[model samples]
Target: MKFASTGLTALLLASVAVPASAETLRWARAGDALTLDPHAQNEGPTHTLNHQIYEPLVLRDEEGTLVPALATDWHVSEDNPNVWVFELREGVTFHDGAEFTADDVVFSLNRAMTEDSDMKELLSSVKEVRAADTYRVEIETEGPNPIMPANLTNMFIMDQEWAEANDAVEVQDYEGGEDTYAASNANGTGAYRLVSREADVRTVLEQNEEYWGADQFPMDVTRIEYTPIQNPATRVAALLSGEVDFIQDVPVQDLGRVSQAQGLEVETAPQNRTIFFGLNVGADDLQTDNIEGENPLANRQVREAMNLAINRDAIRQVVMRDQSIPAGVIAPPFVNGWTEELDQISTDVDRAKALMEEAGYGDGFSIQLDCPNDRYVNDEAICQAAVGMLAQIGITVNLDTKPKAQHFPLITGFTGDETDFYLVGWGVPTFDSAYIFDYLVHSRDEEYGSWNATGYSNPELDAKIEGLASETDLEARNQAIAEIWEVVQDETMYLPLHHQVLNWGMTDNIDVPVDPEDQPKFKRFALN
Candidate 1:
């Protein structure tokens, strides 16, 4: 229950706020990372913080390009199409001074694929990782994965020796509340080293003088002071008052105020993420619903009614302040399966009511909606809008708002589909549709569907989703992706709200562009 209350969380974070100096950057965001164990959580804020302290085999730069970090180059082996060969970067060292080698790569990848690892879905195609030599490693997959490199951008490499020494080889069971050395401390071969950490309050980091990328990238930021301010006004005030130099999430309502302020500037871009509501379609009976013997969400008519009830245009204009792109599909336009036609949305209260009546729920039914207050841009506002909209279709929504730390776990199934309906945002780091299918659309087999709380499972669809890993034929793979999208849309699996728009508020003296994924690499920041 850390950071359980917004007012208290904001006060605690504000008390620890530090001033920015020429060699230091004070960064503020809406939420703090759930844990420091890099592979434990696949979340935006967590990955943003971890990216500074952990070195991935490959990383998406400020320009969103797949660039090398630990691995110098990687390609499929000529001997075996299912095998990928990676050449490790030489002369690299972790924060604790452990030498980077192929053994670390092999060990880290194996660890990330464990059951407790939230990042296992990205490596689901892999069969094994083997160290071929001092600086060479081989990853054998179940089939020929054409986009394996794309998936490794966030697969952080941990120092195997350091992990073993600290007894942190296993991924921290984040949802289970298991605290280990790795969760509170970190040792990685990245640009910054963890100086101090206080969950949901303050985290201090210092630049690694011995970082291998020192000469390669800008490496301008020498020290960092990151604070999570849950309140939107407080976050904006920190940037305005010069207590913080940069804020990753600039509230849409405050974008103009921040931009017009004396020394502040706002940079915006279309984020590669979509916000949506997930229904527990697989459940026979919903725990929160007032109705008995059956789950309204399980019925396609009810699901369709809920989907049709959402007025994306209204939410965009009012709740989002026109800072969103209305989406009819969960996959953003940046993803492979997205189509202009599929991104189109329509709303009809009469139609939705008719569908609800056809499903035999003519009067109404009440269900609880678990939403994150600090996760996305105006997340609670969007959920609040949904409440009134869904009521038109005879579904009374009792809204429950929590911090991202508590809210995300509910959708991730730590308690096994703990809530009937919830709000979640997804960004495709791979820019591939398979990433969505593997995690959000796949059956909740505990391995494939880490975020698929819907419980809707189709063996045939699952086979197609799994086949996407090794399918080398480009056209065939794309066709299969289209087919999968068609099924998802037809099933009315989710109520997709809209694609997010990112607005970063920072001091005018800071030089950094808005990252499409909203994950800014501080090493790229330059002081004007």
Candidate 2:
């Protein structure tokens, strides 16, 4: 009976395996966009492809725990928290068969730090990348970087020799929707090779049989295809119509529709993504350069009032259809080590009203609220809900909604210019609270961090963050992070919102892992 069961298992697996001649797997997404360079964009689609074609020195497991990838093992120097030594796996080859070495790692680090790279901000303190030998590398950071391994997970390594050969040694200064070779062409040491990219239509990748880690999985999948179908309804339609195998970012409104589909399965997981409104505190008033009848938002009382006025619970229920959990901090609870002391601000409208009145705004004034219509799950509707709630508190909000493409450039562009107030979602790639304090709350130094978009800055908090970055002691570091959060919350840099939830729809034949990191990767997925 055991022998018969084994035979049946083998037969089932063989039946699902694609023939060697079937070289392409058709994949689909919301739309065609963004630069092809892995470092060009921090969005989900970019990460999805980056994980496929580029290999990070370190990677995270399904549980969001750190794991070794290109680097076989690593150690921190006893003398300095700033120094990290990594031993590379020998005998690994880039997609072009060029030998992987320490030089390539160093070159990749330098390129990622180049001013042209959008990814440069992510590794501002990486002082230098030096090779100890052909198969070993040492990174000397400006300060203690406990999140080095996690941060490195996003730095996809490129071949130094091949890049130099093609004059692509430098990361191109390409913006989303811009055409560049790095966007169109891919050369890396990952498990797949780019076969063709037909803009919005589809991107095709073939199995890299020569991949050094080929034995890691029973890789019967020979091809992967990516298509962008931005509309949630359309995406679900395609999956149900059998035109695509998998679909992500399923709208909560359509959960019932997709769940009822025959031969399909819906898998849902809580994401670490936080969707919140970013009030441009630095802006003196609305973008129109005039203060409207007692600008309540121009005062701290008004800002806090705005925070208290909205009920996140209701937004989760009505807009998200109970698909999301209310958030208290920027870092989600699942980020593990960081969210132990997570606390939510009070949702007392009475206090909010009193504060607004004390700020000399007995009568509320009008202000424009910008929102990205297509960015996060039910993003626009959430903003609409906030507007309605704020209106009840006597603040009149003029809603201006646009796609992320137009919204981001106008609000949080390189100039530190932002809309009066806008809704934005943040995912801490390092899964650390320091990312919130350093980038968001510090200052938009451009060279340093991301969270400072609101132009929120506190010298004392900055110093604490600086000290924590290099502190080797885990207790001390965690304490420092807690302090930073206290300062951010007390000062109201960003109104804390709930962590997001991801719901993906797929056919029974496809199996995909759900990661709170929110990067939709298909390398490990298989046909059941």
Candidate 3:
């Protein structure tokens, strides 16, 4: 059992000089990629760093538009409706001069389906990945999968031979703290090649001259020096001092100051993510609460009361500095199944107190809330604000803030079900409700719910979530989504906070639009 942690895991590094050449883009973010192993973790920052050095069959442009990458074209086979046939791009080679072929696609996709791969859940519907020809591959799904392309945007492919040679065939066991060669090294068909890495300290990348899209893209940024500055003030100072060219997240409070500074710009966009708190309502007894042999969160009345106690507008105004949209549902507007009615939420303190009394917890109960300090914008502050709000409904919250690297495993099940209450930010790369249901709302099992920290489980709900992947009719699929969401909302397993708004701060010379998913492809960067 994980207790409340007062300390944070720090990544200490010495001050280093940042090259400010027009061809070099100095980048800084609040957190670092967990690993260089592409399939190890399905995280935004990790994928952002990996995208610079790796290529996926399908990629999302800065505007979140699906574009061809390794696969020149893809479509469901006319004869086999359940199979997705992909025409591989020719004349492509890995960084080590290995030819890219269908064999690599078959090997990599199967590798990603391994137990250790966090990308496995995304491919749960996939039956088999086989090579039809030298440059052609086919992915046979359990049924007709309409959203196959949407899921491939971030499913990076790797060189099978390289993995075998480096003994990195297995995805790195990140949660178990197992390290492998791939954890720190990479070779891909992407526009840039990894030069050096120092975990959370700093990393360097140089443009790949032989990259297939070298001529197709701007390729203006020849080198990328990435640094993760956990402290917001230090990160902002880095940008102000000309030490960094761009920052993925600009603190909301410093947006005006940074945008007004000489030769700087701040671009804003609604992120395709939701910030929320998870409750372990399935457990019989409270893990880290004041009351023993009783889980206050298990009671529906208590959960409803907790939800009512939360003031989303206050968090949006105070914690987010009016940068976030108060959310009623976990799904953002960009998702397919989102509706304003389902996203409408209200707060009533008196109603919450009455609900608590109805649940037989008229006085109060104390529980620990696990949160990440550097992962989300004002993450700790949001938890801090909620701690005070929850107190009004007689729920005493002990907030424990730590670096994401340490905090994520608490809910990820890579370690254990170590947390009863936690904060998590969910980004829908597929922009579908099924993606959310499969990962967050479904019951924890081999095929789904890898991120659902709450112990809540229902066999009927699990069947509905599974049906989404194979549902062919658009009208029927959407209705099923609505029904699933209704169940999720009524349970109140998660307390929705607000939809995050992204702010990318950069120098005026950079010409890159804000990606709602927060993954910036440097190859798309055009430096003036």
- What pairs collide in candidate 1? none
TM-score of each: 0.97, 0.89, 0.96
Q: Which 10-residue window in model 2 sums to the lowest lDDT? A: 1-10
lDDT per residue for candidate 2 within 1-528, as digits (tens), equals: 121222422332234433223334455544344556766665555676778888888888778888888999988877777888999989888878889999999988888887656676667778889998999999998887776777777888888887777767767655334456676788888888888886555678888878878777556567887776655666666666666666777789988888898877888998877888776666544553236433345578888888898798888889989998887666777553455456464588998889888988768777778887666888878888888899877888888887665666654353444576778887777777766555567665656544355766667666776665677789888777777777777677577667899887877666668877767555667666
Candidate 1 lowest-lDDT run of ten: 1-10
Residue-wise C-alpha lDDT for candidate 1, range 188-229, written one tens digit per residue: 988999999998978999999999888877888999999888
Give the alpha-carbon lDDT of every model: 0.89, 0.72, 0.89
Model 1: lDDT equals 0.89
Report the CA-based lDDT of candidate 2 relative to the real structure: 0.72
Per-residue CA lDDT of model 3 for 95-204, tens digit only, reads: 88999999998988898889888888889999999999999999999999999989988888899999999999999999888999999999988999999998877899
Q: Which residue runs does candidate 1 get wrong by more than 4 Å? A: 1-19, 414-417
Point out where model 2 deviates above 4 Å: 1-25, 31-33, 78-81, 174-179, 288-296, 336-341, 411-416
TM-score of 3: 0.96
**Error of model 1, residue 120, in angstroms:** 0.6
